[model samples]
Target: MDTDLGYWIIPLAIIGGAIRVSTPFLFVSLGEALTERSGRINLGLEGTLVFGAMSGYAVAYLTGSPWLGVLAAALCGALFGLVHGVICSLPRVNDIAIGIAMMILGMGLAFYFGKPFVQPVAPDLPAISFGWWSDIPQVRAALEVNVLFLIGAGLAVLLWWMLRATRVGLTLRVVGDSTDAARAMGLRPALIRTCATAVGGAFAGVGGAYLSLYYPGSWNEGISSGQGLMAVALVIFARWNPLACFGAALLFGGAGALGPVLQSVGVSEGYYLFFAAPYVLTLGVLIATSSPKRAMTGAPGELSITK
Candidate 1:
């Protein structure tokens, strides 16, 4: 590799790709963080993510308003979350099993309804031009930050504060810590978990909207690329911290961008290996952060994974 210009291209490409790709992971992981904080593990977010992509794209195509499509996607995602919450609240219901079923259902529905929209062009979300300072076209393109990314970033900060400094946050922590304590304090754990799960799903929906309405700029069966499932793992790596989820998301995004970055730098040999960067990073994080004998310290007491 050329030691001068080539090195800069790879970092720039990775930076740009990280910003673009991290949006979905940020949103999905944030949602999962909240859901897990409420003592529930919702694996169906993959389904919600895909369904949101379909709904967002279809609505944008029909209404000529990308923002409206985003709203529709969030609503659809919340509905999916509600379904999971309700089913899981039942006696002897397994949340993991229900989540898996919901994931399949979401995928099936999206594929069935999204066929017509496979080739249609939906209006894309507008982007902010941070690249104007740079004269280079690639640099300019790399710096074109999406408005949704800003929103997601702001949301991460807001969520972190809300979890630490609010009464609702305390209640959620209590419920997650112990169902008996919540009941004694007159807080309804099930209701709280349901609401948290639904809100989380809504956040994931917005992430899905970013995927189709901004980056990649389309909706299709292959649009998701396992990001939803990856987001679940991201939450674990983040140790259920909302702020940490945001950071973890960026890391995953950087990993995802590795292949393109390497290719951009003219490193053609074994470039395909870089495509697995995100998964490999995820595994590495799990191994490094997890302990065999002791549970992750920050995990919620009532969470299923802990049990």
Candidate 2:
């Protein structure tokens, strides 16, 4: 009976982990997708994520409201993005260099200020049980999902529609594809990109909030683990489409869940290495995206990486 249960347990655990793990990816990748769509790259999102996690956790602990924590995280992320945008707008400023600096700064700030809350218990985000109808424990566990994940899913579709049908979306595309053209039309690319970057930063902050207040449910320096950096490649893989970002995030999330799922079924030997699956998958995505055979059709024209 135990051996028979293994087959059911493995797939169910992986599926559950994928759902749990993918929430952060979904939010971060959407944020990156939006920023890239505006022709700005925020590599410092890792910093934004970590710092947001800290701020969110701290606020939640103090306010006793998990929702407020998410709000705080998003606001802080927007502030970080605003700073990155302002600096990058300066003449002769390199976006990549500024991004790296922001990344380091965000992490340092999070680590330093977060030291006080390391041992304190904070409120956690709530979950909705889609599996309440099921009597089986595995099915119930696998079906239980977070509210943020639902929001992220709906947000992906909404963002996709906004990008396709909205006037602001058209303006963003115009600016991203050709800043010179935007200048000719009297549009300010700098202002537009700055605002978009801030919005993107807010999205990343929510992803951080999820990490600290939901799944792992704790404030820690190690929570992010380069998920922010990997989100850049994820945006590329999704061809900068918000809806595609959802699928790509789930793929990466599923990769991340592989190790623990395997270990749960008695495959503990070296299962720790399976934790690297997401990073390895990210490398593979980068390689596939960079292939000469791929036309790179949907990439923003003004992005330095694409150029």
Candidate 3:
């Protein structure tokens, strides 16, 4: 390949990778955004993600409709979130610990039910094509992106508007910023958190559904590879903004696909190093964004983690 061609190929690959890999991160990051905005962190989203994938694929296989599978995954994810919310509400039970426990439980349940779904060919999601205008094959290939990517972008904008300019968003922010203040205003913190967690879970489930129903339509032990966990980090990196989450997800998507792209081009010797790019970027962002002094001085007063 020409040197200039190689440079162009990288950008094209990045675009393709971003479109393909960001769906899961977008869903999970958005979900985590909602959960964190409620002053609770659902670290168990990893398990919720995998379980949702398994449940989505299994249900789609059984019902012959991918939409129903998406619904089933959302319901299952909501149930898990409910469990996490209820358990964490108990005195002396830390939300993080409960989240970890829920993660284990979700994974175990998924494995149990997913064993029978390892090989079934489920219905795949249809993509929307707008590539006819592109005369170049490479350009057309990039333009023919997944529909979920567009949906995710739309959701991010919608959520940002809702959070910044709506009553419900204000309530959630108040509750997240100060439980006592929310209670003073006669808003039940527990209720708000419960609702937020459930909504977040639903988003995560949809993300999972996208994984099994569209990207790679089959169940297996390795369907998801830490996309859920990275999404949690993504939320923080995005500064709890839904719109920012979209950009962050695309960045993560590019990082994730770098390994495979390099491998395809006969550069497989340091494959593991390429795979570490996303996590390293996440950590770097976290370090850059977090400051103990600033956190102590500026964090929401009722937020337990900062305290």
Candidate 4:
């Protein structure tokens, strides 16, 4: 085995990893951020993510436009979130259990609809080129970043600003911190949570769309590998901050890329272990940050999971 010291490769790989892995987390984390901010936790986002992948791919294949597919996916996701939010708002229903049920339902629906799209060639999202300043082939290749990365970054900043500087953001935080307080302030907690869940679902759907339309086109049962679940953990690790979520997502993405990077270097002895890196990192972070005593401290007070 040739173990060459290609210093540039490491940086390139990091950049590529950030670009490739952050999209899904970006959407999921941001969506969760919104939901959590509104005093709710939609664990069914895993299903939303997968179902969105299928919906997006199928729509894009039929419409010949990846953007439309993304829109359709978002709509589908919103509908799913609506279902979750409405059901969870019931007097005796539990959000966590309902979320789990929704996840299974979403996955089943995706498989059922996605069966025909298993081998179809759908239109993919376009990438932004940043290789103009580079003359070297490696540099050029490294600079070939996806547009979704930029969009995710921009969204982080936008969300951060909105959360801190906007009245709507204030309302969301208030709702999360104390639904009763929000009611005292004459705000409708249920409405806010419902809207937040819908928005979050849309984001997850878009993320799923990215997986199907860009990173790996076409549809199959195994297109996703728990990226959706990891994104939920990432939201807590990120402390409900969209900007922090972006950084956390990049880290998770790097962990995910380790397997392929090692494989590229002809190291395959521990490929399966490498594949587990992202989940392990997620678990570690959850343990480090989670505490029963401080559970509702960091989490929104009204959130069912935190309670």
Who is ahead in TM-score, 2 or 4? 2
lDDT of 2 by residue, 101-133 (tens): 999999999999999999999989999899989
The TM-scores of all predictions, comma-separated, are 0.96, 0.94, 0.92, 0.92
Give one digit per residue, the lDDT tens place, for model 3 in 1-307: 1233444656777787888889999999999888888888899888999999999999999999888998999998898888887776777778888888888888888999899899779998777766788566765666667767788899999999998999999998998898888999999888888888888888898899889988866678788888898898788788889998999999998887788777766777989999899889888877776777556322334445655
Residue 202's lDDT within candidate 2 is 98
In candidate 1, stretches whose alpha carbon ends up further than 4 angstroms from where it belongs are 1-4
Candidate 3: global Cα-lDDT?
0.84
**Best candidate, TM-score:** 1
Candidates in order have lDDT scores of: 0.89, 0.89, 0.84, 0.85
Clashes in model 1: which pairs? none
Candidate 3 stretches with Cα past 4 Å from truth are 1-5, 266-269, 290-293, 296-303
**Superposition TM-score, candidate 1 onto the true structure:** 0.96
Candidate 1 — worst ten consecutive residues by lDDT sum? Answer: 1-10
Pairs of residues at least 3 apart in sequence or in different chains that clash in candidate 4: none
Better of 1 and 4 by TM-score: 1
- Model 1's C-alpha root-mean-square deviation from the true structure amounts to 2.1
